[model samples]
Target: MNRKLICYLLSSLLLLLNCNKVMSASWEITYPRTSSDSDKSTDYPLKVLALALEQTGVNFQLIPSEKHYTQGKNLSRLKDNREINVVWSMTDRQREKDLLPIRIPIYKGLIGWRLFLIREDMADRFKYIQKVDHLLKLSPIQGRDWPDTKILQANSFNVVTNINHSALGPMLSNAQGDFFPRSMLEIWDEIETLQTDNKLIIQDSLGLQYPAAMYFFVNNQNRPLAHLIRTGLEKAVANGKFDKLFNQTYQSYIDRTKLKKRKFYRLKNTFLPSETPLDRKELWFKPN
Candidate 1:
């Protein structure tokens, strides 16, 4: 080969190798973890995130942050693009303004369907409550930083706030609060895993409902990632994978809740952003 042709061929090969290296590099996606290593609530959302990335045919690694952080701290990290790149949280106006949201409700709006976790002996206290006003008379315990606290308080419910999520269960057990309202998707497993001496049970007959969306959010600068996640989630929904995973993970809980039989008092979610995709009926869960 001529010397000029040989030099050109070597340069082309090096460029091709660099291009391949760039294409093969995997994006490292980090998610936050709570203090509890055994938190099962994170499992479904993690799986859904994996499914979304899988749909995109992207090379990526899913990682849990080594340092435990509170939900508020995790969100702060996400906003700063520090340790965590993505976090799943219930959407509110402030959060939407702070981060780039995927906009697809990861929990299919089930996070707003709440069941009261009350002392087993306190069952009759709620039995005769016929209206939301009556229920409002009972104070519910919630995390101090959680949006649910604001939402509950906004609706005139006297809310007991604790800084720690793990403490809420103990507070409810110790009668520090009248009840602990938990999402239907969460209450079952939480009750099963609670290590309190007090016997807590899901309140029967009465429930509360609101419109909320739990979405995966990234830093505002990470628009590519946000778009990638939204595209994958939408494609999953189109091909039936999203619903399949949703049912597989939560259908049993839904069935156990007996949603259709419960008398649910609907409450207004003032924290819900106006841009929420409420018009998309298929994205939400409705009890038959």
Candidate 2:
């Protein structure tokens, strides 16, 4: 028996054993788990992904983060060994070395650098970001170890990568750094809560605009299965099921009474929770 041939055969067999014509064994969604009410893992994106997968005749076991997903012992395994097959809502470039990006985009958003805020008083020092080169020369800036940092570096912004976004708040509050760049949606609440007097502000600066955004990633080793999953997602979107899922997940976040503040698009389609919603009573720790 040829040793190289034997190894290839074993790898093929393992892939076959793990995934069937219908589905893969299970998937891991890498995200931060915290005490915040928004930390409910069973919410929107996961449900959208799972519903999309099921519609394509695929069945997946949703794996929740015991601790913060990105900061836990599990992420080390995911990074070093490529053990996690599928990760929901991951910025692509940072994990491309170890993880493969699905071609189909799960969501769309503008990816760019936003200025950190301590209070409204210091708004003078930090004005709008006009150029990437100008931002690089400033004091240390912080970001999570994801594609956001890569975008910053690509635009010539010197960034200090941290384990979590929460860590950057203290650094900025203590006057240690100039600003922290982060995804606007993910850190909106955290910034307002962490900054004293509830006076956190983000500068209007567009660093990068990624038109077709992704909300998840899969391990490079499972490239074949990942492609199939993406195809199912596209089908779901085309058939309107994905839109239903998106509305359901996004509705809880948007305040309906604040119609005057919302844009025309958001106001048009009021979101609704899934009909056959997964029992996430176990996942929610806070009172509704």
Candidate 3:
């Protein structure tokens, strides 16, 4: 072959190899996972994440961390970019400072609309408690590292906390806490998955209302990934795919709550950051 032709062919081959490498490269996104068979809370958020990535037309792989960590540990790992690259969590002032938040409420604020899981025997006592003050006298079980624990404590609601997420149910059934305040989106699945034989019933008469946002957080330095995710999520929201998936996942549970019939006591979410998009009514769920 002529020298010029050989040089051209070699350059073409290198270009082809570089193109292949670019095509094969994908973002490796890691998220926390637990061994509990009943914990399906991550299902919807993970789906939303997948949807957002799809919208961005980005090549990415979603991975569950091999090591199970509590919510706090997962956030810490994400902040350090240690194992997990992304974490979905309730936003607080400090959390936003530690990580880049997408600022979209993945649960549409449903995470703050809480219902109580009380021992079946305590049903009558809860039924008569019409005032927030009366209910504040009862203790609620929460994860030690959960934002809800601090929110409850800030609101003067006695909170019993355990580091283990799975232990909260048993604590409620064992009377270690007077009641377990769970998100309406989570209570039904949790009740069905309760391994204990002790009867725990949803306290139907009253609910707690606060303004909270569950956001997808990435390492502070991962601005490109953060921007991509936010762009994809905004696209999903504008296209109505976000609300559709959200409804398909939690509509039945919302119906079961009959929130219209329940009187809700409003509490100030002191942890909620001032920058939360409270003006975006389209991004929140308001029970009629």
**Best TM-score goes to which candidate?**
1
What digit string (tens of lDDT, one per residue) describes model 1 on residues 113-218?
Answer: 9999999889988988989989988989999988888899999999999888999999999999989989999999899888787899889888888898999999
Clashes counted in candidate 3 amount to 0
Model 3 TM? 0.91
lDDT of each: 0.90, 0.49, 0.90
Backbone clashes in model 3, listed as residue pairs: none
Task: Give the per-residue lDDT digits (tens) of candidate 3, residues 75-141.
Answer: 9999888989999999999999999999999999999999988899998898779799898889989
Residue pairs whose backbone atoms clash in candidate 1: none
Which digits, one per residue and each the tens of the lDDT, describe model 2 over residues 1-288?
999999999999988877674364454444334446555443656676676667667555665445545533444555554345456543443444555655444433322213244445556654544554455676555556555555555555566667665667776656566666543334454554674423556543222232224445565666666766777777776787866765465444333213233121110111111221124222111112
Candidate 1 TM-score to native: 0.92
Ranking by TM-score: 1, 3, 2
Runs with alpha carbons beyond 4 Å of true place in candidate 3: 1-24
User: Each prediction's Cα RMSD?
Assistant: 3.7, 12.3, 4.3
